[model samples]
Target chain A: MQKLLDYGPLLLGGAVTTICLAVLSLLLATLLGGWGARAKLLRPRGDPLNKGLIRLQARVATAYTTLARGIPDLVLMLILYFGGQRALNWVTELAGLDTLEFSKFLAGTLAIGLLYGAYLTETFRGAWLAVAKGQGEAAEALGLRGLRAFRLVLFPQFVRHALPGYGNVWQVLVKSTAVVSVIGLEDLVGLANDVGKSQRDPFLFMLVVIVVYLGITSVSGWGFNRLERYYSRGMR
Target chain B: MRFDLVFEHWDLFARGVVTTLELVALSLAVGFCIALPCGLALARGHRSARLIRAYVYVFRGTPLLVQTYLFYYGLGVTLGQYDWVRDSLFWPFLRDAWWIALLVFSLNSGAYATEIIRGAVITIPRGELEAARALGLSDRQVDFLVLIPSALRRALPQYGNEVVFMLHGSVVAGVITIQDIFGVTQTFRARYYVAYEGFLTAAALYMAITFVIVLIFRQLEKRYLAHLGLSR
Candidate 1:
């Protein structure tokens, strides 16, 4: 326990990795979710040439989300850790590259993004649906079609509506980075575990783990509240 | 690429899925039993209720994985002297992976379910209780006849959500080397190095299982809420 602080560099590295992974994944998932919701709402029916395309997209999205949400995050992390490396190895072999690396950091980001993207998709979709129908119709009636209509009316309303739920989802995702630690990602929990193993003081390291998570959650909460207020302006 | 792999391994998969289902079902059932009573007791505002609330908050606030590790590793060190608890005649039964997994999951689920039940209990209409009281019924009798039943019904939808969540959550049992579906799938992946096939199959199976659970809940909701159709 006394020597635990000697590994401060490693602990800082873990925190950086954890925060970066969580933030990047949140950004990517939100963007993907926004696009997915838009496609679901605005896309027209499919033709004989593209039979079942819409249903397929919807099912894929459903499957993505269900799989992500249903399985424990630890299990998801295991699959990504082992499976991602294996797949990358296969690809590298085919390209005749002797050694191409797939960093655990990148794998963690991609896995969390793809998994939580399913959840964000549903949140974004619900938000989109909650946007009042009259606002969109009025935008169209005012000859504000295409990008202008979405920019002036729909997008802002969607963000405002989605912010609260999205904030909750982000909190869940941030906590989920703890799962990546099981796969040997040097996140706070992972570093804590290492520190514990080396010092033989599991409780103290676990406490550090808890404090790190609390710190991250508190900061993100402040950021989320600020965002919520900013988006929620100009409303009664 | 080989369909024969599944045919050859059909028994293993079936056994795994059944074990997984049992794990989920037993935990959910036990958890609900503990949760419903605790929730009711906590809502009663007795002197002991504050302690129960603290228990519920700590359990519900932390992630399930953290709880699982705390029970397994943390307890293993501090409480290792209680070897007879897992031993004796019970050791053969309790030492098994499935049962211990069920125990951890049941406790976790019970904590979450407490909140759901507590919320439902608070929402029971006061008018019905007053009517029962006017009939000269005892307080206990009025509660048994009026309060508990309606509160449980109101709590059903949220309870259904928790059920689905637990069903999915049971996959973590695999982490402790339970031969559940997820564990068996990982073994196949490791053995054959067919990462895609193994995970894709596992993912699809998980999706199918969750879909079925959601479908059953939806039907239950429709049946139970039919009385409120006009309001709906």
Candidate 2:
């Protein structure tokens, strides 16, 4: 019991790192996903002559998301961390420059962000499809264009549609932070492991760790549910 | 670049694949056992949703790596306190490396599978339920005769995803010193210092299994879900 108290601060600190990592990855993933989905969605459908550029972009996005589903997340992370470092070193050496040290944080963030981008591409694509077509026509008729139409007409409805899947992906992303510890990131799992090892009481420590994760996911779940409700206001 | 590194260590990789297969098969089998009854309860019986929800939340909320460690080291400490357990026939099995991995993987898959099963059962046709009851079938008989069979078929596609997921999740067995395929890949990487090739070998091996499982599930879906006319 006393040992739990002793380890609390360190675990909390680690939790902070995990949260920050997840948030950064989440932002990168959402942005990339948005772009990827747009590229896939904006293709010159039913037009053979005008299809060159968008077709290539759509092909690349499709390939990325498809391969991601085929491969495990861990494999992708390992490849990026290990292979990327070597590639970076080779480039630096060719430039006659000092070797660049790869930060675990950056590696982890990029790996997870890239992986989730594939996942969220699918999610955003589905949500985009779910938005009623009439709404877009209505927005255009009202002279709403670019970001304003998206914000006023499409965004709220698509956000509502995306909420359930986003909540799912968020939970998955939170759990995935635990794996970043494998690459030597000082996250919550890493801290829990060190404390558990030193105290010689892994059971209690693991139970606490489980509780920590459960708390994060549950609280986030509640928050997403609230957001969903807010977006769904006045709709049946 | 060193294809020979993987080739020279083919035996190690083979053993890793075997161990990985063993883990995947055993865990899915065991998890199916747990998921079946629990899913039925979640679907039909007056079970406490809170209890079932808590179990799924805890397992699904946390990473499999932490869960593995909790079983491998944490549960071992608690089990060490029991002399009778040590004296029993189950002791040697408990001491085996595969035991804890098996246990944790089963529980992990069980939680996910239970959700799949529950979802399938919940979405079973109300007309079917009425037909079963109107034919004077008991609630238990309705589940056994009509509900579960259809749910199993419906659950197949999601369960295929779970199988691939469990295959990937079992890579953490290396953390517990089980020397599974991922473990062998790590060992190969350490020895050769071939970062990309080492992880790629593991990835290819995993993808092959995933590909095969997906094919089998596709066939199963064709046979079972032909009525739906939605081919994924």
Winning model by DockQ: 2
lDDT of 2 by residue, B1-232 (tens): 8888888889999999999999899999999998988787787654566687778878888889889888887656668668987887877877776898999999999999989999999988899889999999998898789888989988888898889889878888877778898888888888888887878888888888888888999999989888767556
What does DockQ give for each predicted structure? 0.28, 0.68
Off by over 4 Å in 1: A1-3, A7-9, A43-99, A138-153, A218-236, B1-11, B37-53, B81-100, B119-148, B187-197, B230-232
Provide the interface RMSD of candidate 2 in angstroms, 1 decimal place: 1.5
With a 3 Å backbone cut-off (N, CA, C), the pairs that clash in candidate 2 are none
The TM-score between candidate 1 and the true structure equals 0.79
After superposing all C-alphas onto the true structure, candidate 2 shows an RMSD in angstroms of 2.2
Worst 10 residues of 1 chain B by lDDT: B72-81
lDDT of 2 by residue, A1-236 (tens): 99989889998999999999999999888998898899889948666756877788899999887666666667778888877889899999999999898778888888888878888998899999999999988999999998999899999999988888888888888887888887778888888887788888888888888888888988998999898889899697
The positional error of residue B85 in candidate 1, measured at the CA in angstroms, is 9.2
TM-score of chain B of each: 0.87, 0.91
State what share of the real interface contacts each candidate retains.
0.18, 0.66
What is the CA-based DockQ of model 1? 0.28
lDDT of 1 by residue, A23-123 (tens): 99999788878766665665546685454676677666665666666665555666676677778899988998886677777777877787678778888
Report the Cα lDDT for residue A22, model 2.
92
